[model samples]
Target: MTAALWPLQQAVYAKLTGHAPLIALVSGVYDEVPEDAAHPYVTLGSITEDVDDAHNQRGLEASVVLHVWSKYRGFKEAATILAALDTALDRQPLPVAGFKDVSVAHQQHTEVRDPDPDIRHINVSYRVWLTKS
Candidate 1:
């Protein structure tokens, strides 16, 4: 699944649970840039300055994390939910313009098995970072 979906999943989960969710962003520091880019290249200088300012004003940087759990029998269902969430986020407008750079920092999926297990669970975690505009 594409990395973009975590934020959307977190948003949905938060709405359902009425609590903060944990998500993992899965992007690398040196990931290659696409051959065809639409926007001007962003530099660390701009990102750092903006994040620092935002942090100062908010007293903390803004971020979203999502943790999803489901029975092993429903692993595919869970994945589908996450994928749909990603697509929704891509098509939707940001809640605020301050979120300029929304990127994935890490992602992980784990499964547990037990011989006497009545039901298995699949867990997906996502972490994301955002800088205020």
Candidate 2:
């Protein structure tokens, strides 16, 4: 059985960046958080995988976080970004190497007003189910 964490994350990156509308609205999508990045962009956050095996099959429940950052005046920009992200990933088939029939579901999301008073953050979490091929 192969672990699908990195493969799934890569697939998520592909999905997020490939969406034309999302790319247009945001500055960029990234796995690495760059220094001095432009506002209203998305970045890959944490990926935590756990065991979820079944009869004669191996599976994993992956918890992934996608963070939306904005320096806009309010939460609307971040909320819009979150919507695009949900449209891109929620209930979508994410292709992961060494895995078959990967499924993704939107778990939950949170919006945070940064103490800096100049930034807004939205964190979205998704649960991915991957079965070993």
**Which candidate tops lDDT?**
2
- Over 16-131, each residue of candidate 1 has an lDDT whose tens digit, in order, gives 33311212221111123355532212101111112333435331233343333334464564465455434433333343334555544325545544353543433334344554
Could you give candidate 2's per-residue lDDT for residues 1-133 as a string of tens digits?
Answer: 5677788888999999999879988989988868967887999999999988989989998999999999999999999888888889899878888888689899999999899899999989999998898
> Which portions of model 2 miss their true places by more than 4 Å?
none
Winning candidate number (TM-score): 2
Candidate 2 residue 2 C-alpha distance from true site, Å: 2.8
The clash count for each model shown is 17, 0
For each candidate, the alpha-carbon lDDT, in order, equals 0.35, 0.89
Worst 10 residues of 2 by lDDT: 1-10
- TM-scores, all models, native as reference: 0.35, 0.95
Q: Which 10-residue span in candidate 1 carries the lowest summed lDDT?
A: 40-49
